[model samples]
Target: MMNMAQARPIAPNSPSQKQKLPAPRRGLHLSPHMVDVAVQVAVVAALAGIWEFGARFGALNPFLLPPLSVVLGRIWEDLIAGTVPVDLGLTLYRALLGFAIGAVIGIPAGILMARSNVVRWFLDPLVSIGFPMPKIAFLPIFILWFDIYDTSKIIMVAFSCFFPIVAATYAGCSSLDKWPIWSARSFGAGERELLWEVYLPMAMPQILTGLQVALPVGMITTIVTEMLMGGRGVGGAMIMAGRFADSVGVFAGIVQIIILGFVVVKSVEMIRRRILIWHPESRR
Candidate 1:
């Protein structure tokens, strides 16, 4: 009973049917992020290749700049001998301990300074003078007082880190929007509640930025302290290598420091992203 057009069963592979279905995707498609990562990797690889080949081909002096393989071999030897782990552990411990001490003391002082005029007046001069002055200048004094030990080293690092953290915290807390405070007050939020719920949460980004700045400074200070104190750390190892004119050992130490710094910095950035998930910058 159907008409001729309907009577003929439509082909399953007809043009109309084919048009309704999605076209088959061909080959690999890379996202922008993947492309960016590829570019970065390529750049690093190129630089490393240049370094390796230049030294191997005598374009670079073997004594001043040994081939990358030689440096890596030295590092491998240290790793196999178990000395690298101990030295790395000691350096990280001192740096992290000092950073913790600074953060613990600095955050509260910053908040207090922002909240109270009296505290600001009292601490302002000290922070101003201390922040600008080379913090390492006080190392000798610390050495005299605390001796050439972990105590002096840690204190020196903490001192270097404190100023940046406190400054960042104070700036963050003081430059807050008044509307949020007024709203919280109208809702009967107590001082403690306001501080915990409003102030810290709002100021966290700046505080984290300060921490990022302080961490590198702390590491630098730790290295200097280690070198001066002559202890079992990467800095000490580097100094010893220099004394013995061991360029390979010195370069190996440098590589270790670079790796340590890169790892810590990336870790901090990840932490910041996790903590500030709601922040606008985190979306980027």
Candidate 2:
């Protein structure tokens, strides 16, 4: 009924903008993550403060509780003089070498077991028999065979790290969504194409998680080997400190190992976040 001059233009999307893109609602944000971080910081600060006071006033025995200051001072001294770096570098080298060896054997073994029922049948018994046994139980035999050298240490670590990787990878691949395989095959996808597109992508999260599970074990294996083998490491340092009854060194070594484990775990988590950015929890 309106004339042409009275016609109006349609506004560009204001109602849809409000309705479709509602404001980010807020409520009880029970972020366990932030709470966990806060609690850790608070506890650590409290303990440090307590240690500092107890040490200064002689309330805690200096021999048994050497305090944060002493431990930090010793660590700082070693850090500055390059001793800690050298020892830590050697430890890192051993850990990496062992992890690499384990991965070399584990990935293919896992893939084979996953794809072939016959291979899984043959290997399941062997994996079950060996997986639960502590790898350190072989330390004496390893020493006798490999003569307390880096080879034995590396193998021990590799052995400890291997089973978890294989198990997780096998689980991942075996349980992969079957639809992808069927869809790819219907399209005449080759074996390699199916593996690349369907198998690997689906299994990657589990594989990375397996690496996470194995990494700390690798670190511990190397340190334990160092302790038993009398070579240089924080573990060896702990042993040496205990023998000399040096509480400072013993606690310092323990703290050092704890820090190393924390760092390694954090690194793994960072890698997981970066690589598996599409994971559900990660998206949240």
lDDT of 1: 0.95
> lDDT per prediction?
0.95, 0.86
Off by over 4 Å in 2: 1-36
What lDDT score is found at residue 101 in candidate 1?
A: 97
Best by lDDT: 1
Among these predicted structures, which one has the highest TM-score?
Answer: 1
Question: Positional deviation of 3 in candidate 1, in angstroms?
Answer: 11
Error of 1 at 185 (Å): 0.5
* Per-model TM-score on C-alpha atoms: 0.92, 0.84
lDDT of 1 by residue, 161-266 (tens): 9999999999999999999999999999999999999999999999999999999999999999888889899999999999999999999999999999999998
* TM-score of model number 1: 0.92
